[model samples]
Target: MLIARWIFDIDTIDGRSAADVQGAAPAVVLDESVRVVPGRDGEALAFDGRAQAVIPAAPQLVLSQVFGFALAFFVNVTAPPDGEWRGLLYKPVGENDARGVGMWLYPDAMRVRGQVFTAKGPDYVDSRTSLRVGEWTHVAFVADADGMYLYIDGRLDVGVPLEHEVVPPYGPIYLGGQPDRPGFTGLLDDLRVYASALDAGTVQALARPPS
Candidate 1:
């Protein structure tokens, strides 16, 4: 499998802090509040209010790591399913595997409710945290070689194997809800995707705000 490099820096929108960064490979600027700016050390992108953006993956890019947060609402993706779960919001996969996509939430108690269907079967994963609202948190999913690892606020929350081989005509990754479905109702910031598996430390580093 060939891995491609892509970067998205949110610093061009209005009301956003000016940080020098490499923006998204294929990104969308929703409202006028968000902007890409130069960060003290790196590039910084800021979000002021509700906005939506999508980054197109390389044709052969296999999603392995996703890092970002839904400032107020939630971001979503379209993982085109092959068999039973036909047209649902799923994670992306390579040509060989057919297991569904994986996602992780942060701040401990944030609610993540969605429908996941697979050839093997379908299931649900909920939130578990004790933090108050408005607290900044981080979440990551390492879906590939090993399996699925869900990280909440930089810590491991759940890890499971590929319940089923997630084959595709995989759909595009949607931000803020499944395309054509009910849209997400919140703010998303610092979103990123990688073609390789990111270890715990790497995931943590990506989650941290630019210093």
Candidate 2:
């Protein structure tokens, strides 16, 4: 089931925050540079690697065994410098780890990565193909009883075996950026979080452009 979604269609409460279309919680903008721009859907939020937002911790926002998230992104320019990992969505458990699940763009390797951090350590899968700069692309991360999967443009890019059940971190959800790391340099739209793992059909539906 869909637990939370953000379209950034409009700004409210004096433009200091963006409401989650699902009514879960508001994403409070941390920097004034975060702007509402035309998006893949109705409207999108633009992050300049310094703009970010925070959604307070909530029980319904955490995902465990079977869960998934999808979002549309458009890079503003060429990928970041090699070896630079830019944050997309992050929930840091402690100061050093993204304890629950995190999504990032690793332009250094020209790939995207999805991670699930268990008690033992973090396990991740990288997309087999490189990301296209300045193009809107749909990306998702899903985990089920079998393992974790990463999707690009509604297709399964790769999957990794699960060694342990996910251990969700007790932390606020960070959008666009996380602490001590650079933010995403692009436009983001239609971010959705689900309580259950999504199938290929559902992912494809999410990836499809409005006709």
The sequence of per-residue lDDT tens digits that candidate 1 reaches over residues 38-96 is: 43233333332223233344454333223211111112221211122111123444333
Output the number of the TM-score-best candidate: 2
Candidate 2 per-residue lDDT over residues 1-211, each given as its tens digit? 8877777786532466777777765564546777887877677778887678776777777676745433333334235544678888887664355557788877575578888787688888888977777878888888887788888888889998887867766577777777777877888777787888888898878878779
Off by over 4 Å in 2: 11-14, 28-30, 66-82, 94-98
Query: What are the lDDT scores of the predictions, listed in order?
Result: 0.38, 0.72
Q: How many backbone clashes does candidate 2 have?
A: 0
lDDT of 2: 0.72
